[model samples]
Target: MVREVLTVSERAPWWRAPAAVTAGALPCLAFPAPALWWFAYVALVPWILLLRSAPRGRRAALEGWLGGAGFVFAVHHWLLPSLHVFLFAVAALVGLLWIPWALLVRELLGGTPGPGRAAAALVLVPAGWLLSELARSWQGLGGPWGLLGASQWQVAPALRLASVGGVWLVGLLVVAVNCALVLLITAPAARSAALAGVTGCAVLTGAVWLWAPRPEPVGSLRVALVQPGLVPDSPDSPERRFDLGERLTGTLAGQRPDLVVWGESSVGADLAARPDLTRRLAELSARVGAPLLVNVDARGADRPGIRKSAVLVGPGGPTGERYDKMRLVPFGEYVPARALLGWATSVGKAAEENRVPGSAPVLMDLPGRPGVRLGPLVCFESAFPDMSRHLARGGAALLVDQSATSTFQDSWAPAQHASLSALRAAETGRPVVHATLTGISEVRGPSGGRIGPALSTAASTARVYEVPLARGTTLYVRFGDWPAGAALAALAVYCAAAGARAVRLRRPGPEPSAPPARTVRGSAGRRAR
Candidate 1:
């Protein structure tokens, strides 16, 4: 009866792991809000406790599943309308992913983890998270927005981690910290536990406060971001959209900005293909006395309709530099496994495969500044930590993401998604200039925070920004994702070895059931033969 009661309580719906994880994730949005940024660390505690108490295997798996569903579902509830059906499908599929994460947390907390067990247990959570992020962001599953670490864009110290290891590492560390806290709570009073868990976190918080990337002096390039009133679907109305690039440039021309930026897909077709439009943009750049860093959509003329692309244009001519986006939002850009899954691809009449991916990261030369390279990330690419890291690796002075969030016009998706870029800047210690097609175009210093004005696509407006182009590179940019990937691989190997040993130990040992009845039988025989 006691066992039954315990089992029932474990499986009960109320206050389950799902609720804990959900609660933990929901409060993290406070990360982007200045007064509430500290909530991120506090938010993790409950989930950590829940992980500590979970049983193994199926129950642990289910607990984690619920936790994952709650976390993602709560954070991404805004995406339901744009990706409702897809969200449901993806939610169901990702349950498999969460189970192990829950189980891993349980294993790590048990204190039985050796190097192999520790690695195995540790790798599962982050690996699962990265894979899920990758899968969801892909076109077939749904699209990438609001990944967990992205919430910390407004927090300075947390953002620093992104530039170093990418957002995956940030997510990994957050999970690790939560696990550590759980360990700290369960252990008997030990000096090291308090020092490592409580004091370590305190010291780390201080490090975050002081370790911000130094900003470069704004020697020359004062820039402007234009927010057009026209929506994405209605962008075809040129009188409404065409005048934006020109008007914004002309308005900011007096400020003598060396460059002007419009939002992503702001130019419907490739400017190079449209000679008349190119001339008009050149005129705008000339009038502004700066090169225009324009975000172009449509098939590339040079690549012959091979990919969706972005390019640079100036009074002198096109900069001969362009960046094609590598990572694409799955359903938003291209259908997933289309050849195999196209039969079911149409959900609510939203046919997939709207865009193709670019092969490499493109760093454009800012006009008048030969060494100042613009790291270009168009819309979805901004979600990929490695994309920016790749550009930063190749001597990018500034990171620029051109985005169009017109699809989720009514939701807070623009603001939520845009916040992530700030963390990316912090991670790489490079400034990020995020210009959007509809709304929330803004600037972020190396550490994730709003440094300049963000254009509101809700109105026709423009803001000229003097962005500090930092000259130094970060360790994260130089190293890339190799460290984390290596760690994950090592973890996998360790887990495999331990699992093999467990299986061997469990293998039926030498046959037993030795002769046990001889003494009693001998006494009976002596008395009653």
Candidate 2:
């Protein structure tokens, strides 16, 4: 009887959907590798098979959640230590983030997930995953790490899609391939199964190679990035922060940058309030024979309470292009409903006390490169694709990301932080100079290619790079989330319709409907992508 029950469980349709979703989530493990990225692509077969076998409705949802839980747990385990240190009880509660991810996957792969149905997996799963990543990026809840799209950072073909629709598209296409391969294997009609799978993947590969953005080198502009990691300065004594700025300015003067970038909170207080610091940076700009783009993490004099800002100053005067950060980290920036919830804020940095959201995106003029415009994102902001997309679409020639990773010190955080710039550079089809406090300052060129050296967040240092500036927007900058969002919405519609039909079929009969036997096989083993 036990053997029979085990056999039945193995054959159960409910089991297959979860298995396939789990398999699909595997390809996302290629990042932070000593492991090869190409090997990660095969993790799709299980979900494809399971979805093809699943009964509609709740069974599908369960399959998705289990798969999502496994994937999220495996990918984000790095958070355990950090969360444990700061929010011990809340860190233990992190498992909640995976619930929605699972449900969305099962819905997309519902109703046989065959050729006709499988196409929607491309959209629904990627969109759902993207929304999940965006949702979790809120700081108080948790930091955004190991976004699935980021796994393919080093893969050339996958990176190509980044330029066209951002990293999200690559994710969609990868899921689609898994679905299509599953459909072909269980095609039932005995069609050109292998041929169809091969054709689809080939077309995707061909398109990326054909349309990939090539760099057209413009004149190089030398720039320096200053990182003074983690030392604290109070706004009350504005003079305390000025000396640090003075040292950076004094050192950077010899490098002769077209513009110098100070990492997030390089100026501890608001220059508007400090006044003296502004004059010092302006003087540094004059001494260095360039303009300075500096990040401020403090309250504005006029507004009085916003926590983050970026401003560009020429030797002559302020460029008047200042960007306040729009996305605030939940716990780090402000606690949600602090007066009502009231508890977490009392212990650590008050969530609301940290920072406020910026009102709009701003583009400033570059000093040495007269006609070129600059689009900037402060620390934690560069991780968002839409943020950089907004800048790219707005006709900014280049991208600048200023961050302070001093808190992270010498961990995986710097590598993770640096990776965002590569993906952003790929997405915008423009160069990105990611200047960080402490280190890991990097330059990523137009084709998702990286240049120069990585600085350590544990040490104080500065470096210069000759970056190429690109004009005009790429397809990614234009369409934003529409493609992936459409995929997700279409999946929901398809699953809802399919679920209703299955329910009506099961209502009158006690016995479940059975399908003819089919075996699934494709992308199951480690094969070349």
Error of 1 at 509 (Å): 5.8
Give per-residue CA lDDT, model 2, range 1-529, as digits (tens). Answer: 6665455556665546446445645754566533345655556566545643555434444455555555655554444444333454443344345445456555545444454444445445555655655566565555555666677777777777777767777766665555555556555432244346557767976887797555566666677777655565455433443466567667766777887887877666777777777777778788888888888877777886766788898776577878888777656666666676546655555453656787888998786677788899987888788888888888777789988665556455677778778888888888888887666778888767887776665656656787777655667877787656665576578669879999998887677779889875568543633
**Compared with the true structure, what per-residue lDDT tens digits does model 1 show for residues 1-529?**
6676468656666767546557535544653332254555456567656765755455556666666666666565666775667665556565455565566567665544444434333445456555555555554444555566665666556666665566666666555555455445665433244335445545754664567345455453576777775544453554357666567567776787766777776776666678888888887888888887777766667666546566787886677887777777665666667787564455533445456677777778887877888888888778767777778878888888888778776666777767877867876878888887678788887556787666665767778777766767665776776645765675577579779999999899888878766545677688896
Off by over 4 Å in 1: 1-36, 110-144, 180-195, 204-220, 232-235, 299-307, 343-345, 349-353, 457-459, 486-490, 493-497, 500-504, 507-529
Query: What residue runs in model 2 are displaced by over 4 Å at the alpha carbon?
Result: 1-28, 33-36, 43-63, 66-82, 85-145, 178-195, 212-215, 229-245, 346-354, 496-529
RMSD in Å for all candidates = 5.5, 12.9
Error of 1 at 368 (Å): 1.8
Q: List lDDT for all candidates, in order.
A: 0.65, 0.67
Worst 10 residues of 2 by lDDT: 83-92
Score candidate 1 by lDDT. 0.65
TM-score of each: 0.81, 0.77
Residue 474's lDDT within candidate 1 is 64
Query: Scored by Cα lDDT, where does model 2 land?
Result: 0.67
